[model samples]
Target: MKTVILIGAQGHMGQAAMTGLKKHNVITASRSGTGCDHTVDITSKASIKALFEKVGPFDAVVNTVGYCEYANFSEMTDEQWDTTIQSKMVGQINLVNVGLNYINNGGSFTLISGILNVKPIPMAIADATTSGAIDTFVQCVAHELPRQIRINVVNPTVLEEAWDVYGEMMPGFQPVPGALVGKAFERSVDGFITGKVIFVDA
Candidate 1:
């Protein structure tokens, strides 16, 4: 059984991912540290490094958390933009950068990205931009990783489980089941494909 590190374990998406990964030895982590095995602040590289160091060797890392600010394009502030870039784009990237040291050879890294990048909506410019950036980052970095390590990003649309919170903003977009999204991550962790964006849109 592969030892997996699952970040953002307390969130809805994280819980969805946990469904499919239940068979594995999954280590749950989150920023709040409530109801999870550990706490980690993805925005801080030092926190990420510390988490990995404490966990020791692991076979895979699945990150289901990244925050982006939502605001009208015209009203968006510099701080909002910075928050999106730092948390969604750079923070996820840092996971790969720092995790290389502790992950076992051939281990995989699975990151979360939303469908906003391809399917745009109002007031989500920052989120869309960062989502696109994450997809691109995974596609490019997959070629450079050593020791047969693999990486992929899961770009799922609004989940059925989260529709109540995000449905109105998404308009006609269909909400997919969390189980389907979880399977995508399972594929990335157990399969050989790398540098791919596994989309789970119903």
Candidate 2:
């Protein structure tokens, strides 16, 4: 089985992904390092670099977390925008930027992006924009990556498990099972396709 590093391992989505990746050797990570194999702050390149260095070697990487702020466009503060960009956009990108040095050849990267970019909701401009950016980034980077390294983004709608918390915000949108979303990550990690956005909406 491939050795895979799964970020945000404590979150609901991360737990969901773990189900599908059960066959692999999964290394867990989170910002707090609580119950995780290592700690990482995706916003900092140094932190990401250090995690990879500490882990030694891995065959795949799956990122299941990013923070985004919700606010009306008119009321959105500069700090809010900066936080979203740093954590959701630049932070995830940095994983790929820094991970290249340590990841095993032919290994894959699976990133998380939400469905907000395509079906947006009020007060989610920043979140939607970052999700779109990540999708586009993955598509563009797929062509440039060396050593057969592949990349894909999973664009899932609100998860059924998270619906109790996020349901109100989604309104008419349907929530998908976390298991289905996890399978999308499985596809990216185990399949040959790259630069694809696997949507998990039900």
Candidate 3:
């Protein structure tokens, strides 16, 4: 059985991934819940390092943590930008740096992006910018890692869970299920996908 460490393993998508990956030797890392075996703050490399220490080596590491704010670029605060960027972009880079040290050869690293980078909507400036940055990083960094380790990003559209808040605003746009996105994660890790951003809209 391949060992997999999942960050942000308590959120909606994370929970769905956990359910989908039940057959694997899965370990959960996050801020809360007894459901998660490890605790991590993605913005802090020290915390991430500590978790890897406890988990030891693994076949794959999946990061699904990132905070996003919906606001116009002119209205976005420096704090909001920093929070999302650190949580999504820089934090994912940190995961690669840390995970590379412990992953076995042919292991994979999967990070989450969102479709806003390609299909932008109003009030998504912070999210779109970070999403684009992550995809670029994956494409470039795939050649830099050792042991044939691969890196990929999954860009998902709005989830069905967001309907109450964001559905009406997006006329005719379909909301994909978080469970379906879990399958994208499976493909990125188990399939031969590297330096690519898999879009999860259907």
Candidate 4:
């Protein structure tokens, strides 16, 4: 059986992926760590290192953690921006750097980005920039990963469940189902594509 490691498995998209890829042995890491097989802080290299030690080797590693600030650029605080960058941008990088060794040769890596990278929503500067950075990083690093390991990213638009929270705010913006987002992850792991940014809105 293929072994897959997931970060932020307690979150909406993570849980959905867990259900979608039931055939694989899943190792989940998160802050709360509830429902996950293990716990790791995406922000810390040591934590990620410890996590890999416990899980042993994996066929693929998927990251579904990241946060973004939502507000007019002028209203965005330094703290808010840092929170977004640290968790989304730096966390993903850290995961790859520390977790890559745990993946078997020719394995795959899937990272989560957002539609903001291309859509450029109002008051979403940090998100857009971080998302773009992630895509670029994947492209640059894909050439460096050894033994045919592939790297890809999934960029999903607003989720269907998110509508309830911000439905009134986004009048015309349609939300995609969480299950659909999960499918994108499945495709990234199961397919042979590499250095591609898979975008899903419909």
lDDT of each: 0.95, 0.94, 0.86, 0.84
lDDT of 2 at 161: 90
lDDT of 4 by residue, 105-177 (tens): 8888899888877877677899888999999999899888888899999898877866777566556677888
Off by over 4 Å in 3: none
Candidate 3 per-residue lDDT over residues 1-202, each given as its tens digit: 7799988887876875665576789999887645788899888989888988999879999888888877889999999998998888899899999888888999999998888899888888899999999999999998898888999998888778767777876677799887888888888888887999888985
What would the TM-scores of all predictions be?
Answer: 0.99, 0.99, 0.93, 0.93
**Candidate 1 Cα RMSD after full superposition onto the native fold (Å):** 0.6
lDDT score at residue 56, model 4, on the 0-100 scale: 86
**Colliding residue pairs in candidate 4:** none
Lowest-lDDT window of 10 residues in candidate 2?
11-20
> Distance (Å) between predicted and true CA of 164, model 3?
2.9
Consecutive 10-residue window with the lowest summed lDDT within model 4: 163-172
Score candidate 2 by lDDT. 0.94
Candidate 1 minimal-lDDT segment of 10 residues: 14-23
- Clashing residue pairs in all predictions, respectively, total 0, 0, 0, 0
Which ranges of candidate 4 are over 4 A from the true structure? none
**Residue 64 shift from truth in candidate 3, angstroms:** 0.9
